[model samples]
Target: MAKSQTKTKTTKPPVAEKAADAATTAIRLKQDLRMIPLDQLDFSPLNVRKVAASAADDAELLASIRENGIKQNLVVHALSGGKFAVDAGGRRLKALKQLASDGVIPHDYPVSCLVEDEQNATVTSATENLQRSAMHPADQFEAFAQMIAEGRKEDDIALKFGVSVDLVRRRLKLARIAPELIEQFRVGELTLECVMAFTLTDDHDRQMTVWNAVKDSYHIHPQSIKRQLTETAHSASSSIGRFVGIEAYEAAGGILLRDLFDDNAAAHMENPELLERLAVEKLQNAAKVFEVDWKWVEVHLSVDYGAFRSFGRVYPQDIEPDADLLAEENALMAREEELAAANDGADWTDAEADEYYSIEPRLREIEALQKARQPYAAADQAIAGCVVTIGHDGALRVEKGLVRPEDIPVAAEQTEYPADGDTEIAVTRPNVSPPTSSAPVPISDPATTLRKADGISASLADDLRASRQHILRAHLAADYDVAFDAMLYALCEQALSRSYGTEALNISISPFLAQNRETLHPDTVAQKMLDALEQDLAVEWMTLEKPDDFLAMSALPLPQKQSLFAWAVGLAIKPQLLSDNHPTPIIEEIGARLDVDVAACWR
Candidate 1:
């Protein structure tokens, strides 16, 4: 007994912890959940991210707690008076508090807690999640993201939690997702990629549409959702408008300002030219307006494009054309009878109206001078209250303004969201497209044989005269190490050649490439192509009007697989190309033909 006492003494709680334990125990409640008073319970300690009163979760927790007696103690700190800080298990605590309030549980139930500091609230919260893997990745991310927003560096957060920056980024992205979808992910109904794609648009309506579609139609793939959304969102005209950066103008509560605020349009807004056309049409109703054959009048009058409409200061009405312009234009209007006869009384098409309208001979030089004067100034003035924005959000943002990036007001960090995973994802902000050396790969040993090909145009290998020229240049091989491009062309040509029993195949390339500006970055080229294709596929897929975009992939054949490798190799060989950036992908075809140790090459 004496030995046991000494051992107990040796194993006693440390002084610091002993005092903490005593304080914590002092506040402990022995009440059953159904008997405690409301005033005795404090819920601040529990960090409940959501208000899901899942009977299942409740039933499971109650069963576990009754059976296990709260093995994982809740974390809380003391508040002024007798309240406590809640850091976790908020829902369970709520249930207990509710029971106590209803007199089902006692006022003081056995509980656990730790005093958390203001400076360490985030740390405490994040640490709680880290220690317990029960938290969803989204919840953990929100906690970590809170820390970062609270002035913690990403690297510091990473070190504290022993996680990588990428892991942190993914979690942070998950947190940005809508609470509804996030709840789904938390409940194991949705995937992270789905959330990533769904949050592309801020429209909860659109999100729900995609969500229910996924739930009902068995369409879980991100691409299919994106395709469906694109089909719903854009048409040929709207798609083309997107290229000019203003598709949202037609969306609900939308307007395109730059075009609306054009110099001529802005001036004409107050004195809307279409109103004159209307008056003219009214006169035509009374007169024989249909006698005119002027096609110009027919088009312009029909499409009353409201290119100019704005909010803010109204310009004063001016009845007088500048005195000089009025005096000069006196000569322009011919006899009404002769002019009316020329028009044949038809409505003016814009082109026809423009062709028929003649300025006074004396004012031609002055008009030319006015055209040459300050151009960008009007646009700058027009955009003062407006901003160019992406998506059909009511966000009016200004771009390419006189204010430098640094000179803009100290703006709060903007909340940016990516396109919905199901929506045809439109990447509004351009990414610094990296070199398209190959599919994402790492640098492998370059000393190994790297056979280069030209482009994807290559076909089955045939002896090309181009190979001799390259051999003569590189001087490495005249025979075995053939030009991949030449071989690809030969392969393709061979396929075509054999099919038709002719050596020639008519494969025409685009003229656009010929006109492509010299000195363009390869990354830029690849990015442009990728952006176009992504947009097209997204539009086509979303519209539900087009087939799956398997064109680029389907174009390839077994005979052409070698050509794909050769094309990538050519990119890899470029002196400027960081071959390390793009290691070759695991080519199963190549592996089937030759025992390819892709792991070694990738490594």
Candidate 2:
């Protein structure tokens, strides 16, 4: 019965037959090409490529289409209402739509498309995307280089390709890399970034040298390669380089090597010698302003703490202001207040804004005039010099009022003894021959003359003294009254006797020597405390001219005065352990008075 039924040859149903015929017809019409209107097209829901295009990609695609009409046709399926849905080339469709919206192309602009049925849309879209291959990076770099060699301007090429000028430059830079490096990149031995690093210098030999040295090691990083190539060069951002700007350097025939891949990285200057010379010349020019008012003016490329330590500093002195000057200052202040109030939150015309801002410079000028009036004493100016150098921030730094050691005045020796009526006793020490018989000899205490334990080595004695001094310093720093008294005594001794005698503290008012400066480790607790105190110190007086300094210092509050006094006195204290191991009686007395906790401080 089954054989008979099959032999009967049943006819297919009309609906099924028609469906098969329609599918066959759709397959035949799959490649149907047509000019679809921009406004009549939309993205297909069945598109397999769901990832959105980036803004840069859209811009580039749009630019390409604008420069050259669409080179590839979009795959689309017919929709109801005579509309079409893009199955492939979604980005291209987007760019065309944007152009139509921007009026660059008409809304009905004919877009070439390959029409397909809805059933095959997704498969067709996927095939179109998956089968495409991007141009190799090496080929891209070579193409860009070829275009450039053909006399095409970078800007024009960027415009034509819808890419950034910087990108074009980078591509060219890659192409110009040492041929050997490019080969390594082509063969996968080097990464794109490594190849880019080779473009930092144009000298192929130098690039090859660095490459050969690092290629075999695990440290063939881009930055490491750049470091080796530019080891002998100076960065444009360096203190000296910034001081002598790139423009100035270039004007002086200095060559700069730029990094095409990194815009933020500073360029390297090939002529370091030329840069240094320019820096010195610029500093010398800046020093000329001080040469007239100073006893001597010296130009230094960097701060020489050693040279500065040997010089004494003189501060400015205050002078009484004339009535006219006071009046002028008051007037400027009143005007400034008025302008500030007027401009608080109000939007004003440009003219009004200009007027409001003008008050600042005028006030600054007045302040400068006032500062100028405050001058160093003629006697100080005769001995003090100035040093001009570059600051860490690359600004011109002028250190004024530096008195060289040789220029310091020598105090006259005592030619006359105190009058017989004077009751002051003249002290005689181990070093000085007993004061003339005419002068009363002061009695010396046995306790003060005792030497340190005889068996201690010089080094051990110094260590012990340093330990004791640190303990004493910690305790002294906490007592303002004692530090002040000690400082006052030291100053009076120098003023009245022109010499120190059996002093507990070394109060020379001198900067730290180079060797001594090295011992002050920044991580130490003492140094940390000093740093904190320095942040709060009233240093406005230091910036004032000689005539205004005294007034500014006097204006400081009592607490601020005490802080400055303590800091100054603290710096003057040092280890009193003599090389000969002599007992420092004065230091011992100070420690006893302060109740210094040696164990607590030393640990």
lDDT against the true structure, each candidate: 0.42, 0.71
TM-score of 2: 0.55
The digit string of per-residue lDDT tens for model 1 on 1-603 reads 565544334455689788988877656432212222335446663353545667756655654444344455555555678665566666667766655566665667755544544455556666766676576667786898799899998776665554556656656755665678878878867765566666445456777777776664322545444444443332222212322223323332333221111122111011123332332344344233322311111111121111111112112122434556545545454433345576574865666555444433335755543443423333223322221222121122122222222222332222224556543553232111122222212111122112223332344234433653454556424444334334443332222111222132233221122233355453565546533443332212121221111222233454544543443232223222125566444443444577745444432
State candidate 1's TM-score.
Answer: 0.23
Model 2 per-residue lDDT tens digits across residues 1-603: 565545567888999999999998877766488888888999888888777778888889899899888999888988899999999988898898889888899999999888877899889988988999888788889999999889999998998899999899889888878888888888977877778878888889999998888787532446557767777787776667778999999999999988787677678888978988899899989988888888888777765223454455666667876668678778878866776777582866687678767767877767756766777766677778887887654677777777655565554222324568453654221111111122111121122223324556789779766875786799889998667655644542332222334165675553233346557566766557766885576643432222223344555677887776676555556466445377678777877887976555432
Indicate which candidate wins on lDDT: 2
lDDT of 1: 0.42
RMSD of 2: 20.2
Residues forming the 10-long window of minimal summed lDDT in candidate 2: 428-437
After superposition, candidate 1 runs with Cα above 4 Å error: 1-136, 148-173, 228-232, 235-239, 246-603
Judging by TM-score against the true structure, name the best candidate. 2
Error of model 2, residue 362, in angstroms: 16
